[model samples]
Target: MTRTAAIIGGGVIGGGWAARFLLNGWDVKICDPDPEAQRKIGEVLANARRSLPGLSDVALPEEGTLSFHADLSEAVAGATWIQESVPERLELKHKVFAQIQAACAPEAVIGSSTSGFKPSELQQGAARPAQIVVAHPFNPVYLLPLVELVTAEQEVAERAAQILTGIGMLPLFLRKEIDAHVADRLLEAVWREALWLVKDGIATTEEIDNAIRYGFGLRWAQMGLFETYRIAGGEAGMKHFMAQFGPALKWPWTKLTDVPDFTDELVDLIAGQSDEQSGAHTIRELERIRDTNLVAILRALKGQGWGAGALLTDHDKRVRAATALAARAVDGVTPGEPILTQARAVPLDWTDYNGHMNEARYLDAFSMATDRFMEFIGCDADYIAAGGSYFTAETHIQYVDEVHAGARIEVKTQMLLGAGKKLQLFHWMYAGERLLATAEHFLLHVSLETRRPSEPGPEVAEGLRLVAEAQADMPYPEGAGRTIRRPG
Candidate 1:
């Protein structure tokens, strides 16, 4: 089904939520009091268009339409999910919740994107408060994988977790509702110690940050603090480390529990040090730097299969292909029509052993492009998820030319055969006017759950027939009878 999400508040975080959902192919309706909400969200969406595509190796699910509504009630009326990203004030949340409850369906999940507030506190004075859950996603919500889901009602939390998981986010369930959830609580502890270090002249702001990031941060990236320290114990593990360091807990070395006085001197000193370290960059420049670093770090962690590694694996899994021959998945083609995808330069990660784009990635890229073609013909998630999909059964690939790394290429797909149980497709990969590769594929419609040959659903079959009918008059490939090229 094409899910619909209503995003209330069109600021950075809210815009991020909209992009995440919309890029994942959910229809989005945004409502905010500010008249400039559309402009602000547009800017965010532009940046997201570039960033979100690269985050996943797979071609993104077809993006859903975006709508801006001035009326909050209208926005929530038909939305399946209501993501409240209003300002973090309790009163503001309560106010929005009241309106959302009045307008939204009772079964719809109401997600509050609050970083520090408990769901219980946010749900106060609500008519059907049990529907609300804290789905606190990290900053740059479109890119970050972690979303802390907390709710006193386990059902609500579970539902939210399932929904977020479907869209490719790691939802960590909180055992109990705390002020800042799990991630932020760890961050708060570090922040408190950082302030004390700065105040006591033990370390400057930048120095303490560097000490943590350059040292433990590297370990924390792959394995968390406890797990990393457990390895440090040399087979004794966490228990041994705790026993050895337990006595150090008595030292008055940390003012962790105590709050730092935010005096002007302290603020100025911290600000000056931060400025010296990194504040020279403009916000846009800083964002670009952050995105680049995130990409590189996540790429390095891909082998770890922990944290970002799992995420990268999931993203890559979405992009699939057959052995040596590039597999092409086709849908929505009238029996004789064609579908096309304009290619771009291969990203840095797609290159391989020869420093040129890898053979496997050509198939990967073609598969992604084919998915977008399916989406164009209405063979989207709901269509495939409902027990019907076109699986490639046979393929022949001819590499006519080589495309170097970073070279822009394009693909054109034509429907060659359409029968009751099988379909044949031909894809031509081109670099400008030169044909670089030609892929001939035979696909079978199958039940996703059963893994057995099956007829397409009524809607999918009808769309396929329409596309096939248009291409019925076209000629087959010239090399149709040649031996299939085995994958290298």
Candidate 2:
């Protein structure tokens, strides 16, 4: 079914929500009274369009329709999912919720993107309290996957979670209402510590930030505090670590006695330090730097299948299943073979100092194409799970041209030859209309159990034979097999 999402605010958080829904193929209608709402959301969407899809090679759903409305009721008329992102004033929210409750369809689920408010508070005086759930998300909602769900009713929370998950977000449901919810509570604790560190002249804001970004942030990115502590416990785990560090908990390393008052003098001191620290970059430049670093870090984690990396893995699977790969010759005897097997956006991290794609990414693109080729020939996840698979024994690559980030790239795969346990294939990679590189791979069918080269089962072998025969008459790809020789 086509989905319609209504966003009730047009600020940073609201604009981000709009981007996530609109880009994920859900028709999005936004209601914001501000005259500049359209421009605000457009700017956010521009940044979102550039960053989010580049996280994975697979394509996102074709973008859905976007429209703005002057009236709240008209904006939300047919929406199945209504998200309220109005300002955080209690009276203002109560009024907004009442308006939303009156306008919302009975089947629609209304969510509030309030970081600090509990769902119960947001639903105060609402006609349908059960429909109002808190679905708070971080800034740049289009990229980050985590959404904290807090609601009075369990079933409503679960339903909201399902909807968020469909759009590639990880919904964390809170059983009971809390002032700040889980993540904010953790963030508050760190914030307090950082503030005290700054106020007491212990560390400057930049120095403290560097401490986190350089030292513990990387560990925290993949392994949360508890897990890292658990490992610190050594062979015995959490309990052992607790025993060793229990005494230090009372030490005066932290001055978390209380929050320092924001006196004018202190405020100026902090602001001055910030200006000197990062005054050269605009907000947008800083944002891009932050986002690029996040993409790189998350992509690294994805490689290891941990933390936010795991979220990317899940999103990529769903994306691949929904993407439009070229005509797949699954049975191998199909009439027209697939010319293009794998398509992906060039992620930001693939570029090096030269501003073009680095040398190694060409091989990575070809390798995924080879994976797709195996899928075409009937060796997919299920086949590999049953202990049948192919391993790349050797590869040769030719770099033809330079490609840059945000370029739409694809791999056109054709078989050179395949028989028995050995199969050779060629992949031509293109950035838009220009061929960027070519790769040749030699693969050996391997039985996972024996860990040795072996003949594939009946189905895959037949598939390979059909493909080989279909391409048998075609001339070999240029530079299929080559070696370097020096003048002797």
After superposition, candidate 2 runs with Cα above 4 Å error: 257-488
Task: Count steric clashes of candidate 2.
Answer: 0
Best by lDDT: 2
For model 1, the local distance difference test gives 0.75
What stretches of model 1 exceed 4 Å from their correct place? 257-488
TM-score of each: 0.55, 0.57
Residue-wise C-alpha lDDT for candidate 2, range 101-217, written one tens digit per residue: 788797799988888998878877888889898899998899999999998787787789889998989998888989988999889988999998889899999888778864568
Q: What are the C-alpha RMSDs, in order, of all predicted structures?
A: 18.6, 19.6
Name the lDDT value of residue 445 in candidate 1: 78
lDDT of each residue in 1-488, candidate 1, tens digit only: 88999999999999999989999999999999898999999988998898889878789899999999988898998898899999888998998999999999998999989999998899889999799989998878888888988877877777888889988899998889989988998898888888877887898976876676545675566546654544444444444555566556566777763545555565456445544554455445544544445555666667667654576677665653322112223423334545665456666667666877678877876776566555554567888866677787787777777778568788877766655556666788888898888777777778889999887666666656676776768776666536644222
